[model samples]
Target: MDSLEQLNQRLREGVRCDGDYPPVPGEGNPNSPVVLIGHSPSGTDAQTGRPYSGPAGELLDELLAEAGVKREELYITNLVKCWTWREENGLRVNRTPSAKEIKEWVPAWLKPELELIRPKAIVCMGGPTAQHFLGKDFKITLQGGQWLELPEDSPYLKLTGHRLDPKPFVMGVVQPNYLTHLQEHAPETYPAARANLVADLLKIKRVLEGKLPKPKAPKQEELDIPF
Candidate 1:
């Protein structure tokens, strides 16, 4: 098996999809017990050549600090390695990746990286990422922060074509970028979103440290309440 470094190098030199920016590799310790997955890189990330290093990145750092987790202690990556974009008024505007683009990249890039890192817990930030791993019908508004176990025959595992020695615990959280926008434009929703992000990260920390209890399904009432 190629090492994580080797696989990352391969990805760096790989071809980018049409209308996509170059791939941005995950950062932080490969041996970290937790992994954070986001939807994709933004224009800032594409320019910085780093995942989560823009305004959204700042929000993430703040949330992680509030949760008592360090940015350097968790492996951070995106669902899609490349930046999906469109030219808008002579400037490249970041756009959400299509399902086809996501499907193509996972097996080719993200899956291999996961196989090598083998994190104990995974926090999927944003709807697309959560849906990608959890299933097509996943609703982050209802399910954020709820712990879930990957089934033995999960489609995600099948898609990866890699067997994880110990299946990682998974949870969903709101995207930092969305939260930032909320903070600026929808002040009323910002506090709740920020609280939810911090709480979710704390849960991930507990899971990684083996302090969290066994997983259970969220109640209907719990699902009804937005996080």
Candidate 2:
């Protein structure tokens, strides 16, 4: 797919992940410097064809604004195309997707998206996303704001339909949805999570600006040790 039209065509006619949702909005540039990857669009977002249109998105917009990043500056998307939700006790609750669903659909659409957008940094929003991209061994509490280098042969590249070349770095941050939970119950931790989001955003900014090189790998000594 050489253009957005082709990409959308492939997503619609070529691949069938979830048809309940609308086509992903925004012209996801393969050349964008940063990419913010999250879970599927929330109920509101799915309806509007915009990522993060709900409460969590509101928090994300606030946090990004604080970090001096505009919504248009970075490419944003989700690992899953449809919301995995069911009515529970008369209210709808989002649930983590089954492994089978991810395995089947991720490579078909989401992974190719990363290869196409080739962001300088990919901020995995929550544990599910981090687990998908970083691996099952990833512990969000310990490594949430820390940087991990992409594998030597990982597909962080700009694809000219077939050719792929290194394009950007990938990073992880606490998901805004997680913070929305904290904001409702654990108000104290909410600020810290938001701060971490801003700090991570700034770190990525510095790396992109050439002020800081790729972050060094975290050592055991730097692990989060909550006593």
Candidate 3:
């Protein structure tokens, strides 16, 4: 994991894939101080072999532009590198990885990525993702956009089995899909939520500018693993 080349080679050579879809290795600055981790790939991501695509990608691009951030300046990837789905009513639908699936994949896929990039901060794209590193009851409405640290036993760290010294700080933000949904189905609430999303996006810039203080790991109490 000394380089992105080694990481991607491991992903391509040693990693097992169901062969329905291959792992979507992260794209962007290999040494970025921030990484955006999603729960898993969407249908479009699987099809295009990219992390964000279609509506979600569009919204993310626009938000990055508005926040005065460039995509190439940040690393982006999903916790689960490949896509997961189930068939229902004669249709194929996207689904989150099961606890079992996550257990099987994360150490192999995500651990090394973090080890290589060593981002100083991460943005969890949605509640479930936020919960992965933060705890289950980490209320996004109350805590999003604030400086925080992952618990010592945070799933991302433990599952990856790699402890980054002075571990990367954490922040939570609304997923693009949620914002898109809000815009389409709940217009009344969309404006306020979208504004919050923009503010959260800007925090990345503040972090890079050395304006926000790095968070120390909060005291450990029993916290729910968001399986």
State which candidate has the highest lDDT: 1
Tens digits of lDDT, candidate 2, 56-132: 87887888788877766777777666665677998766666667666655666665676667555667777677656
The stretch of ten residues in a row with the least summed lDDT in candidate 2 is 155-164
Q: Model 1, poorest ten-residue lDDT window?
A: 218-227
**What value does the lDDT take at residue 193 in candidate 3?**
78
Q: Where's the lowest-lDDT run of ten residues in candidate 3?
A: 218-227
Query: Count of backbone clashes for each model?
Result: 0, 5, 0
Runs of candidate 3 with Cα error greater than 4 angstroms are 13-19, 212-227
How many residue pairs of model 1 clash at the backbone? 0
Candidate 2, residue 79: how far the Cα is off, in Å: 1.1
- Identify the runs in model 2 with alpha carbons over 4 angstroms from their true place: 9-19, 23-30, 152-164, 207-212, 218-227
Error of 1 at 202 (Å): 1.0
TM-score of each: 0.88, 0.79, 0.88
Sorted by lDDT (best first), the order is: 1, 3, 2
lDDT of 3 by residue, 1-227 (tens): 35787787667566544545667677888877888988888877777768887668789989988898888889998888777888899876778777787777778777778877878888988767887888766766667677687787677666776788548789878788788787788899988878888888998987666665466433333433231
Error of 1 at 184 (Å): 2.8
Better of 2 and 3 by TM-score: 3
